[model samples]
Target: MSFLRQRKTTSQIPLYTGLQIQTSSSAVPIQIVYGANKIAPNVIWTGGFSYTTEKTKAGKGGGSISGYDYRCGFALGLCEGPINAVGGVWSGQSITYLWNLGLGLFYGSMPQTPWGYLTASFPGQDLAYGGLAYVATASFDLGSSPSLPSLSFDVHGLLVGTGLINSWDANPALVIQDLLTNPQYGVGFPAASIDSTTLLGGSGGSSYQAYCTAAHLALSPVLANQEAASSILSRWLQLTNTAAVWSGGKLKFITYGDAPLTQSGVSFIPNVTPIYDLADDDFVISDDADPVEVVRSDPFTAKNWVTLETLDRNNWYDATPVQVWDQNAIELYGLHMDSSITAHEICEPSIGRISAQLLLQRSLYVRNTYQFKLGFEYCLLEPMDLVAISDVGLGMNKFPVRIVSIEEDGSGILSLTAEDFTGGAATAAAYPVQAGSNTALDHGVSPSPVNQVIIFEPPPDLTNGVAEVWIAISGGLAPIYKLADGTTGES
Candidate 1:
């Protein structure tokens, strides 16, 4: 057999430039404005989404509550150029109108409505497309004499499908097909609408069933379309046991078993070709050695169930409740109550499962963390994306982790903070027990017989012929002892 050398592929970083700004409130299609020389090269954008379950007391008859929070923001520099009547920064009438609102200009004595839809995009990068953002704050900062005469704009708002500002009425039991295709209530993307073809993976059918069986899925009197969608999506996922991702102007319903998208040179894989060029001087990696807080919560035992309340077509209260618990989790991390209670409209078995999953997932975050700083090599990496990191010298080989946060500095360097997703449960299981470790000789033990003896094995590396032992009585103080010479110590 002929021997062949395995060749490694070089990581290529995509060059990203230009930001496209579009308006969605207008009837006519507005031209997408590209941020060229007018916009600063170092544009910073942040998007965050998370779902958490709050534990409740055992006898409260309450199940775990799952809630999601999503937000996005963008900060960029805009050059205030000379206003030409026809084609300058403030030229066209429409441009002037938007600029006036962005600048918070007052109409006569009253301030004009500053609410509008803004979509930012980067034409050079595949993953740089942004969702609709309600321009909540458009603050501008004028620099000092030494700095360039530029205007810095900070845009912050909820994602398009997350606000509760719109109101509409619909059938109580709307199917997924109708809800998504009706053009009024569902995803209204022209070129990026979701369909049955997209939901083939995972629990898409179950999610569809959940959506169809949902009672009074209509938007509330003061709910926005996006907010309504968020609620519906959350409930559907909870019931169907599926996951959906919104990116690049499209909504993709995915399952846990779906193959993760592998981006070359972006993910770290140990013993394999490096996806990133670590030898670059600008590349920096820092380890966060802080102990991860162990999050423990009581499982949704059979005694504790979820209450799903919904309004029927006649506006009557319809409640369905179920129990969702994982015996393994409960056995590992005793009964820790999560007291926060939140109401959900949809009542399905999947709700409890989703909540339990949330608890189990949260418990897995108790692991070491690492932060990476690369020079514009991984700008396309988004939040929630799984990446591999393998630094053999640092004892980190192809460690799979998820990106928790992404930040871009003024110099265009991208900084990412990631956590070990696979090591949390093990770390938590191996945590040292703190009970009976402290010495308090002044404390007196009650006149009760010590009936229970607890023994803790010493670490394998410690060859000393000694183990920790504790003696306890039902109503008396517990004492600790080292088994070597029977030395007694009060805990």
Candidate 2:
């Protein structure tokens, strides 16, 4: 384990997928999603990636015509498996298009029908991207804009109850565990390599899954194609202060904090009890370095105010920002501010407010930083494990510390860095009461192709040779009538 100075493995992931850029490349990989995510599909079939421009007469006379209306046609690859369904299609980041407007969705069904655009463009090619969810659009109107708009989708990849846990889709721990262990469309880690006991919140500790559900911090993050697994894992860990280990050839996952004291109220285990009590004699004797160095967090690096921004489920998943501050700390520290963005699918104000409060409190507490070294026998100690330090030189007695970093060297020594910790410091208050507007309606569903048409050319005296057509429909939605011909009609 001396090779523990490992290089980061998740450098490829983007910070937040508030926008998923569409890519067109031969070597680009398709995504394998678990649970739900907002994804930007890869362009797998660009054969129909053409456009149309229309310039119509302004006010029934020629010459001074209206600007051109550009329409684009393309096919996109979403992810593996026959997903539950696809929701709205977002243009760039904000504008969302109705499903029936020239957009077609296939839920990665086996033996998928060849896409209409594909079948029409290349008559003999029957490449259906079988067993892969995708979207095909025959025409997307740009309405006086020449450039094609960027596109993304809201997709629910897998939501079946496969006995992993009750409502696994809503439990991030269960969802992540399933993703890593499932042989299909997952990283496919071997069963034996996983330590399921701890990951499922077993033993004396509370489950991470329960905390997420109670905190309203469940995730709907996009795991786009070509993104490394380590990136996704790292993101989840950072969001919840979680840690994953591969000790003894068995992988395990642990969330740093204990379970919420109250499922819905503002409560969290910021720091656990110390696992080991260490003295100067327990540290590895070094000729060139000090074994223990007491540390107080750098005040210059401290923050009294924290703002958290993430999706607000109560507001149609709109981006919401919430700020919390330590009034006394601001008076003492002059208002140092810090901001963070998370991808969790939050639904309550208390969730965001409580999380921000935690950050602010931790900043105000200014946890200690302790640097030390220990022999290989102490290699089992992982980051986040609380330790009690008793030092004669500093006259410190059982001082609590939280490990934040660990590095191993060739000399079979563990280099560690820790900060002062108290479980109470990071526990703050929040209310489940919502503080936002009502949510927008869900996206429109794709309607069937409008095939029943009745054309009437009236007589000369009948309405002055104008053909007036009227139809009645019932229990129906606004028709999704964007067709391949680039013409639109309403009933």
Q: Which candidate is the best by TM-score?
A: 2
What TM-score would each prediction reach against the true structure?
Answer: 0.33, 0.63
What would the C-alpha RMSD of candidate 1 be, to one decimal place?
30.9
Clashes by residue pair, model 2:
367-420, 368-419, 368-420
Model 2, position 185, has a per-residue lDDT of: 64
- All candidates' lDDT scores? 0.34, 0.64
Error of 1 at 138 (Å): 57
Which 10-residue window in model 1 sums to the lowest lDDT?
Answer: 30-39
Global Cα RMSD, each model: 30.9, 20.4
Q: Give the TM-score of candidate 1.
A: 0.33
**lDDT tens digits, residues 1-491, model 1?**
33686777754332222222332233322111111111111233322212223334445666543322222333322211111111112222112233543432111111223223233333332121232211222332211111112232221111211111112122122333444554433356453456444442222232322221121122211122234566765664543333566645566553221121211112211111223433223355347532122223333432222223322211111233323334555576554444333323322223233333343444333345567676676676655466666554466555666556778889887777765555322111111212212233555754554555555555655646556554433554667666667877765
Model 2 score (lDDT): 0.64
Judge candidate 1 against the unseen true structure and give its global Cα lDDT, from 0 to 1. 0.34
lDDT for 291 (candidate 2): 68
